[model samples]
Target: MKLHEKPLIRYATSKTPVDKEGHLYKKGERNTSYQKRWFILKGNLLFYYDKRSDREPLGVIVLEGCSVQLCESNENYAFDIRYEGPGIRTYKLAAEDQRTQEAWVKALLWANFSRLRMLVQDLERTYEQVRVDSGPRHRLTVLGIESEQVTTHLGRPVHGRAATHRPAPSTFTSEPLENFVELHERYRKEVDAVRQEWLSKRNQQHGDPPVADLVDLN
Candidate 1:
């Protein structure tokens, strides 16, 4: 999906200690300290933003079968809500400072779309590996396509009813195997291209400097 077209959300947290330096007062003096913070997303997605004030957020981590949705109260008023999973309560955004809200929005967008795309690429790699390991004998028939009747390598019927009926071959022909390999390679390259493009766009948006080489201090 296009970046602008995708839904955006925000979540933030902040903390302030009552005292930064330890109290060096009378022995009977009482000192109490506490932290105040909260987090929310897309105007209604709320959660406890637990983190240190000096550190960037670890980010929103979605679990298995989790998904985000955009709901509208009116024709033009909409909010992005994230679901934990089926039949679970959703987290909503809460009140936050303007700067915190903006930062959260940026992080949310990156996590929702860019991170998700990376995960898709990983899954694609796993799928390609499984396909390769399973060999070429497996045929994927499209729905509504006619099923072909063929004989197995052992000279038994593949799909017809008979006393000696056996299953079809598990591997594909040399030509099909080569084609599959080529397609898998092309898909990997495409994924890499898209990832690089995304990284470039993110760097431009954030005004981040290009990666620097590591120095050997030793």
Candidate 2:
């Protein structure tokens, strides 16, 4: 949808801690550079402001259909949120550490998929009703358009029999939210397990001490 036509729903919000700085970088000559802005994830919307608890947001990135990538530490130790939405483009945000970057990624993904889960539930309910009311022999009226069959499988409509009594196959191992939580936990474990090696490789390539190099040790 168009930016102007987008809905404003605040599902969640978080920010960087004092010890761990966060930055919202806009694309410019210095794409790797960091900007001082408080990052907040509200549902699928990521907003930034000049300061904590700011009234107006500087910009927003709709995480729906967006892809995220963590830049190599040697470069900037920042992450990119690439979105194909409206006039806004990819956003490069810097976090204090790998953990922080992961946090942002996790939050953004949850927001995106959580919204999706809700949409899926709504669609499933509607599909179930249609399957029941329109039996295999009855034509279905949808959007004012009559159809020989709508769908029974949410994939195909059976022409001979209506399996309305059958409940939709349960795909989730548990509740959708619970499944997400489990996945998020798995992600954290995996990331933490590789914390040492990943940081070693990243820092080594990052020169280990880019800042200290600016000064002479002799």
Candidate 3:
């Protein structure tokens, strides 16, 4: 199946929620600065609403090219999601408690990773679509996937914002083995960094000892 032809399997949800929580922000005068909302993580999009069955979503946050960082303590379980994509945005949100906040962060990271892996798989699938091949090896690759480019460093979108991004133009190249090898090394380091971060967080959640310093990624 083509990239867009595949089913949308992005799913994220916060297990804990505060009743009728409102995202604190300002509007015009004579209007209440806050509105009641239900924040939810579903698929690759983090959206919220007055209710689950509501026809229109208050906002949608794309998981691609996004990153999430848990915030310091606040009255609301405050945290931030930063998006580095074309429609760049940083979202500030708070939940009822720490559990809810942690859940949100984990869900966001998982969804973002899923999106990144999908892109990688799509690139591998595109190997058959290549019109050019690299030197004698006859290799075709763009992501051949050097790791830095595939990080799940997603961005955040505001609750009241609409999706305003267009697909980026393709930049595939049929580079030689040396280029691919260099890319592999670079991406390998980046992937290791991300893997370490994930492992640290995962260990903390599992109440387990730290992983060994040396890892055989192969």
Candidate 4:
């Protein structure tokens, strides 16, 4: 049995945010000829249209669990969207140029939720650690708190430019020194642990010969 595109039709204008939208030549499954189509990539979905002004997609491809790869074909800048499962046909597409091909391939790979979710998780963890390490005062300074007020006060007309207004004494209680001590200790431990792990792996890969491997006949 041969695959057909009739079953792939999901006729509706997608309201999802589009990651990439461009024209690409798609290889016809039946005709084996390349056809110019307007391609729109939303999250985990690749929708194509016969015309760019078309209100609905001609077909929608669920990109989940599928792999996009550059392939050698008669067409230039050809790539394949392959899935190792039944009933789903591999989509072959080609871009106008090498730059467009690379861009489309990268966009398609990043179109999946799994890839975006991992990226979001990594960013969250990294920013969360930065938040934890920074003090409240430091965070407030970063947010420009009290900066405008200070600037306004300083910019006011004074007796002389050399005799600017002196800032009032700070009434806020200083953060505990113990907190800094604890923070330093925690960071030191984490760094030491990471260094040790790296050294262990390095030694396993390129350490000196073992005692058992060394022998003296003398």
Q: For model 4, how does the per-residue alpha-carbon lDDT over 122-177 read when each residue is reduced to its tens digit?
A: 43344335444432322212113232232232232212111111212111111221
Question: In model 4, where is the ten-residue run with the lowest total lDDT?
Answer: 158-167
lDDT of 1: 0.32
What's the residue-level lDDT of 28 in candidate 2? 39
Task: Give candidate 3's whole-model lDDT.
Answer: 0.45
Task: State the weakest 10-residue window (summed lDDT) of model 1.
Answer: 20-29
Residue 118 accuracy (lDDT) in model 4: 43
In candidate 3, stretches whose alpha carbon ends up further than 4 angstroms from where it belongs are 1-36, 85-87, 128-218
Report the lDDT of model 4 for residue 187: 37
> What is the descending lDDT order?
4, 2, 3, 1
Query: Of the candidates numbered 3 and 4, which has the greater TM-score value?
Result: 4
The candidate scoring highest on lDDT is 4
Each prediction's whole-model lDDT (CA): 0.32, 0.46, 0.45, 0.56
Q: Lowest summed lDDT over 10 consecutive residues: which window, candidate 3?
A: 158-167
Q: Which parts of model 4 have CA positions greater than 4 angstroms off?
A: 1-14, 113-218
